[model samples]
Target: MNNPAPGASAPPPAPAARRTIDIVNASLKRRYAREARFRFMGAAAVFLGLLFVGVLFGDIVAKGYTAFAQTYIQVPVYFDSATLDPDGSRDPQVLANADYLGLVKASLRTLFPQVTGRAQQRALYALISAGAPQQLQTMVRQYPSVLGTTRDVWLIAGADVDMLVKGQIDRELPEADRRIKDSTLTLVDQLKTEGRIEQRFNTGFFTNGTSREPELAGIAGALAGTFYTLALTLLLSFPIGVGAALYLQEFAPKNRWTDLIEVNINNLAAVPSIVFGLLGLAVFINVFGVPRSTPLVGALVLALMTLPTIIIASRAALQSVPPSIREAALGVGASPLQTQFHHVLPLALPGIMTGAIIGMARALGESAPLLMIGMIAFIVDIPQGITDSATVLPVQIYLWADSPERGFVERTSAAILVLLGFMVVMNLAAVLLRRRFERRW
Candidate 1:
């Protein structure tokens, strides 16, 4: 190197080169350790979340699994002509009017002859469902020739007795502490020993409607209401959402009015669901005079709530289509409408459907809006149409959760399982549709 002049400053020292891997610096080691710790923390958080989900599902399955089966008793019913059909005509009307309650009580009395006092007899009769009369009526109508005959018939047990037989109500507890009395337990055990009581698949739980009696209650009405509401929601939301998205993304001028509308839609999507319920109450029920608790009102309300979500999703989907597609279509002399309908819309449909599914799923689980419109009421009859009195699955769950009966606890869990099942199916369908139709650019 040449020497510097007296007035000139010496060149600055050169920077140190990076050390080899064989001699790593302490700073590098610290950095690697920090990165490793961060990764572990992230993994731990994810594991904890999954573990919580597993615990929840396991608990629900444990509780609700028993609700799928019911206890039934085989009673020797003597269809005496005097009690069932005094006229001997076996007319269905006569059968409907007959005292089937007397026949059921008589059968139970014969089964336990030792119980004689009025109180004992009352307790014994309480083991069977009060709805047994209706069940007997159905049996008689199905086979009118069975009149004046003695035959064994399977009848449903009462909810308390059902719980005892299902092993839900503990026998070890003191008689006063338990819902089932010692006498009732003895009779249940005797019946079980004789193979007269058995657990069978509970078809009534699916086929019937809400009842004050838990054993007689079912989810058919709520299930039907959910279907009707969803049908209406999809019918109203999909086309309108898609149309609005197409216009805003492709056809509408970029102006303040359009910007304001976009902002409002975004804000609406974030609004609490109950707010929409209140809106529906004011507009559809109070102003338009639509019937309360009807699926029509429910769908209209859900449509308003779901509209913003669908519009946002559809706009995003429409925007994602490559500009090259539009250009190519227009280059071939296709008009704006033709370009959108024939080219862009077809490619964008998969994403649009995914958004629709999400919106529908959100609507399916919403109960607050429906509650505002009176859908939380107990509806015993399966709705024959959208305008009929009805409740949805979420509302059914809410009602059951509020019930004081021990049986409704299991029912509430079962309803939750059912609602989750529906959501899973909807999401799966969306995924399948996307995979089937999505094209690689």
Candidate 2:
């Protein structure tokens, strides 16, 4: 080492440590700057996602909110006993089969006797929905005394008139470009001026079934199918998924078979949902001969699709039960099965149920798989059992969306709102169930 100068302060040591700290300080500022940028980007991404979701919700609500009500025209019907029962016999079948539509037409003509030409009369008749006949029949059958009297009854208007009343059709557009011609528009306005045409809450929209005519179409069949499919799916998937999870997590010996199953379960969760539809097509529909387009087949397919999620969620819930709980149960002289079932299962039940419900919700929204099983068929009758022909809400929406009618457009949006509402309800249920039964330890 070099000798220090006599009596002089040692030459100032090279400022290495200080220089090193300066370097670090410079890089630290850059690092912090980068981190801030990253946070800003993350927040921006989240904000963009939420913005898009809000826009979508707003659009759906705006289009669908109007479908809850429909336009109707009050017609003075003279239900002549001669037209209903020519022989003067009060036969229910004869009354039921009478030309109720004819009565409605006669009433409209009486109201506008100047509408003489066939074309003008046809336009007048077109103002009323075909469902008016059914409505009249129902009314007459319920009250036999009305068969010979004149009564003003409100009847659902045709799709065109309903749209016009709802202001969905553009008035500024040329009459040639519009479905409602000038003559029809004049008739509609006259009726409106007379205080006979109006809008009311559409009961048939909820109570009726699918129809080629938009005004007569309803979601009752779809709702019933959804209920039946989900019920059967829950029944089949919950017990099977939970039981398998318990067996694998608590009792099964560690081996290659279990490892294979573990990998397969993971793989199945990622499998395209459409594959399950095809599997359902091959196995349930072809091999087992389950009725095509029935809720039974749909339930089987959805159960298969949901099994992986339930199994994974259940296993995770079971593992969450602390090992100490198992040791304590065993220490108290509990058998292995008893330790798992009596002690662990009760604590994990909420998670298992939540997982099952979420899986069912996913199954509820699925349409591709159902389409493969022929659930895309136009099912008009409400399903009463799992074996009955059915169409769920998603499929109903799909069918309606594909229709080339103005009325169906609103109905489609309304159906989507209903579906989103259901999914929200289900997810909320999961949260509530967890909060209700969660054991933090």
Candidate 3:
């Protein structure tokens, strides 16, 4: 390495070190500007996402919060034995079959004696829900001694009357254009003046089942269906998904077969969810004869849909456990199974749980899958078990949204709010669980 010729003059002596602040190369400046732009764009995207979420939540809450209250009219329901139960025997079946409707009509007529004409009377009768009689029947059945007494009962008003009482219906609208007639609206106002019209917290919305009457419709059955479906989904998916993941990651030999399986699982995660509904219909319902419209079938379908997600997440978690941990455990006389079960698996649990919760949140909002298996049917009874006919909360929302009743609009929104609330709770719970189990090392 002969030194450069003296004429090279030492290549103009090496430039003195410059302060970083002074070294503002154009390329470096451009790169930094690009990074700043990227950060600004990312922040803007996040803000936009948060803004949309807030707006959506605000709209839902505003539309639905009113549904939690129901209007009622306090009317005297005289339990005339002749009108209600001609039979002296107090048989439950006979009592149920009694003319409770007549009693309600009589009570209403007694209050509005001025309402004459058949058409006017019919309109007046429309102010009270047909379900009111059923309410009275339940009341009397609960209090058998009230069979012979005249008692004041707070009865749910009809959809139109309920809307009017809640000020949702415009009384100034033309009688032809309004659901509640002017005469009926006047009577409702009269009842309001009498201190009998009241709005109460809708306990029945949480207690009773669905009904044909919008005023009587409740989400109890749908809530029960969701509970059973989710419980079954979690029970079946967690173990099966985790087991498959473990076998693939920890036990199975690396081969084309395993690779094919992994590919299929990843594909399944992106398949249209409704396709799974169709598969459930063809396989579980048609081929296997599983009862359609039951939570059991819904659970089975959801479990299948959730399996790929859980398996992928669990495998990733298991793989993330440092190989050093496996090597150290094996070097210390620990069996492979012990290494996984006692060490790696425990550390991976938080990730598995996080995935499971996200999967469940997806399942909870799924309606199309449940709809394919006959869960779209209008069910009035709360499901007693997984096999009982039922609809989930999302399906219920769909049903209510399709209903023609003005009241159902609010109900649909309310159900959506409830579903959203449940999702928020599940996400929060997942965060808590992850934090609780997180192992830094």
Candidate 4:
């Protein structure tokens, strides 16, 4: 290069410095723009996810809130001595043999004094649950002395009345086409005015067992059964799952046997839930002679289903623990078990619990396996023990949903809400546990 004249003064160093600054500034701007796009995409994904969840919650609440309200009819029935005790004395056998439907009919007549025709009485009679007669019979058997007295009784009405009171009935429909006649509506209004028919918080929803009639249906039995089954599952699966994970992660020799085990675990995770159910039926029910449809059987099946998930998640969590922590614990003369329990386990606990609970939530919603094990059958009484017959929420919902009656639709939706509530509680518990036990270091 030729030397420039002295006066040229080295073509000002400012231009080259400006070019370098421009290049760096452009590169930073481009990087910042890309970062902003990624952040916006992430925020948009979060918003969409929240929106979907909100819609689902709103729909469930709207459709299922009515299940919490129950309607009851209050009526006074006179127990005539002729039917209850012909001898006019308290005879337990005679009282037991008393006509309960007669009492119900008399009560209905008293409730609707405005109508006297036999056909209308018969029509009004259809508005009472079929089980009401048995209920009255039971009451009389329990209280034999009440035979010759008039007493006020609050009884569950039929599903039609329930639907009407809950606004599920279309009032504009013609009287001939409506399941509930106009006469019943007139009586309902009168009863409403007299405070004899009212809606109250339905303790029955949580206290009573399943029924064919929507008015008599309750999830208490199923709820209890689910609780027992899940409790047992957690008890059995957690220790075993975690212990296996620890051994595999910390001490097991890496060999073909280990590899085969790992592969089997991964394969088991992908197995259909119903397959596990069938296995449980074959092995636990048939081979071992465990009672079918019991909470114990259900819990065992669920534990098997959840094991793979727990193992995989736990191993991942254990592996995520920094090796340096283990080395330090060993440096301080800590046994491997002690180091794992004291240091590594605490760090991995949040992830482990998250996985376990998520797996449990999956188990709670599973109905296919439950169906195979006879959890689909009707359970009129609460289960007394793990060996007792029982059902779960999903099975209850399935049984109800399969009913041909229109009332079961709402019942199914209601059961779904209950199941969803359980799932939400489980997930919330997992989130809380994760936050409460999480270790950043």
Where model 3 places Cα greater than 4 Å from the true spot, the runs are 1-39
Each model's total of backbone clashes: 0, 0, 0, 0
Give TM per candidate: 0.95, 0.94, 0.92, 0.85
Report the lDDT tens digits of candidate 3 across residue range 1-31. Answer: 1233344333444444222223434346578
Clashing pairs in 4: none
- What would you estimate as the lDDT of candidate 3? 0.88
Task: Please give the TM-score that candidate 2 achieves against the real structure.
Answer: 0.94
What RMSD value applies to candidate 4? 5.4
Estimate, for each residue in 309-387, the C-alpha lDDT of model 1 and write its tens digit. 9999999999999999999999999999999999999899898999999999999999999999999999999998999
For all candidates in order, the CA lDDT equals 0.90, 0.90, 0.88, 0.85
Q: lDDT: which is higher, 1 or 3?
A: 1
Assess candidate 4 and give its TM-score to the true structure: 0.85
Q: What is the number of residue pairs that collide in model 4?
A: 0
Q: In model 4, where is the ten-residue run with the lowest total lDDT?
A: 1-10
Worst 10 residues of 2 by lDDT: 1-10
Model 3 deviation from the true structure expressed as Cα RMSD, one decimal place: 5.6
Q: RMSD of each candidate?
A: 5.7, 5.2, 5.6, 5.4
True lDDT of residue 350, candidate 3: 96
